[model samples]
Target: SGCDTQTVVNNNGSTEYGLFQINNKIWCRDNHIPHSRDICGISCDKFLDDDLTDDIMCVKKILDNV
Candidate 1:
């Protein structure tokens, strides 16, 4: 369950962020990218905080969709 909240650039040009490792191409939007689904209705930066309330909520939304 322990994971880093820092942003990580992947080899394929996508970015993963926060404890959940949410991807920019699907769950979150990278400002540099033109398009993203952003199903959680939140910026990727929100998940990078130590407080995980927003991240947990976003995770629930994603789980609901799946």
Candidate 2:
């Protein structure tokens, strides 16, 4: 079930992105979309980078909440 940073999957009508496969409907937001929790407090684009610094931070937040 693992995927790379550039991997994108369609879940019903929603989108999941990046290595962590973060869901756009909950963890990240699209500019024109609404009701996104965005609990990571970051843009979805940030997770698409290879650096992984911000991605790790956001993953920590997700883990902390679990």
Candidate 3:
């Protein structure tokens, strides 16, 4: 997927970003999401950049939590 790729998963404004499709509702912060969580402690927009390092780290964090 493109670095800036994003998809709205539901009508409630829940969105996923980048190659991993990290969700703003739980993994990252997004202003558009009224009740978003930053469990990965990252801005959702960071996942939209070309750098995949942070994205991978966030994924690892998610997996650890799981």
CA lDDT of every candidate: 0.82, 0.76, 0.83
Q: Which 10 residues in a row give candidate 1 its minimum summed lDDT?
A: 25-34
lDDT of 3 by residue, 1-66 (tens): 454456547676688888889999999987877677789988888887778999999999999988
What digit string (tens of lDDT, one per residue) describes model 2 on residues 1-66?
A: 275786465746666768888877778777634778998877888777787888888888889988
TM-score of 3: 0.80
Query: Order of all candidates by TM-score, from best down to worst?
Result: 1, 3, 2
RMSD for all candidates, in order, please. Answer: 1.6, 2.0, 2.3
Reference-based lDDT, residue 52, model 2: 84
TM-score of each: 0.83, 0.78, 0.80
TM-score attained by model 2 = 0.78
Question: 1-66, model 1: which lDDT tens digit per residue?
Answer: 267788888898888889988878778776955598888777889878898998888888889988
Clashing pairs in model 3?
none
Which regions of candidate 2 are displaced past 4 Å? 1-3
Give the clash count for each candidate.
0, 0, 0
Number of the candidate with higher lDDT, 1 or 3: 3
Error (Å) of candidate 3 at residue 38 is 0.7
